[model samples]
Target: MTLTHNRKPDESKTAVLAVNVGKPQALPGQKREVMSGIVKHPVSGPVFLSFTGMTGDAQADLEHHGGPDKAVCVYDYSRYAALEELMNRKLDWGACGENLTVEGCREDEVRIGDVYELGEATVQVSQPRQPCFKLGARYDYKELPVYFQDSGHTGFYFRVLQEGEVAPSAVFRRISTDPASLTILDANRIMHQGKQDSMGMRTLLAIPTLSDSWKQTLLKRLTKLESEQQG
Candidate 1:
């Protein structure tokens, strides 16, 4: 997830290399299993993109995972090798629990509210994917989440605007330009890396395309920061 990259990400257009979906599997309570939907399997051909999620995909933690605002979870293809170098382990496409493993969709240049025509469906960038305990659970590395956040390789989510079929053969092309232009990298920086930057938090709050949960979080943080500054 580090800014250091083994490969430069192409931001012009995105190409789907694999489509993935997963159902929650019951895990042993003592095994650090959070009943996560992070274990995904790649699918071939076309899959229906709905307002909630893919056809077979089901999230164990619906409160944090699924909804209209997070219909699809996408991961940048460039992060795998970069992360592997840092972690010294091999990672697969679906390791990050993303529904779509895509190339040319790096977070540095990707902006919140940027609309794209992905295959037949229309989707807008909603927010950066936040790592939870499940990420460390799946990888058996308790500190992985910390490293992931620091690397700024956090993947992002897309809210589906129009329902349609998405396939591996389709290109995720940017259809509209965002005026607010808040990149996912900066969002992550403000939310996780630099919480004291009230100005950065305000910048993210101004973006109408930001996810509801993120907006509320920033608002609360900003209030707390202001109170602390006043105190």
Candidate 2:
């Protein structure tokens, strides 16, 4: 399926792949720390993979909850002109909520179900956005949810199909497609109250944490809907 957008694809985009390490003397699983690096796609796994506007503020809250050095966003790896503009600022940090600061590649080009190849790993786009409580405290802008809703860049999450170490300068590419009909954005929209009736059962089955009771209840409803769709 072709993903249509008003803008052309920018293949030179860059981003970061930051992991969480507790402390200076700790391993990866010990604690959470944000590191810097370059990446091709923003929504792949082993990275924070958060959206643009609210992510900076949300990172602060995550740090407060767990560690002070929480990794936020990976940088925007698509626009060179925008990247240069941001770099010209005298600020010591490269915006907040970004563990992996990226430049060059076309992030917006990615639709739901798109697979990004990050060296030894393959990341599959999962849900659209996970708006959590951490957001409210980060910006103190109680309406962050609305901000995400309005702005379309609600970043995508990725499931790790293959595990491997990623670095700042690592290269990434695209891989295969499963149920090419689904998209991360569309799935997320469906997950919301809008197009729930149109989502595929296979996609719904992938969400493991979606409570058994809720799943069963939804299953019953979906069973009826499936009959209707088939009819």
Question: Which candidate wins on lDDT?
Answer: 1
For residues 69-93, write the lDDT of model 1, one tens digit per residue. 8889999988887667666776666
Estimated TM-score per prediction?
0.91, 0.48
lDDT (C-alpha, whole model) for all candidates: 0.85, 0.40
Q: How much is 30 displaced in model 1, in angstroms?
A: 4.5
Question: How far does residue 42 in candidate 1 sit from its true spot (Å)?
Answer: 0.8
56-87: candidate 2 lDDT, tens digit per residue: 22322332222211122332333323322433
TM-score attained by model 1: 0.91
Clashing pairs in 1: 1-151
Q: Where is model 1 more than 4 Å wrong at Cα?
A: 1-13, 27-33
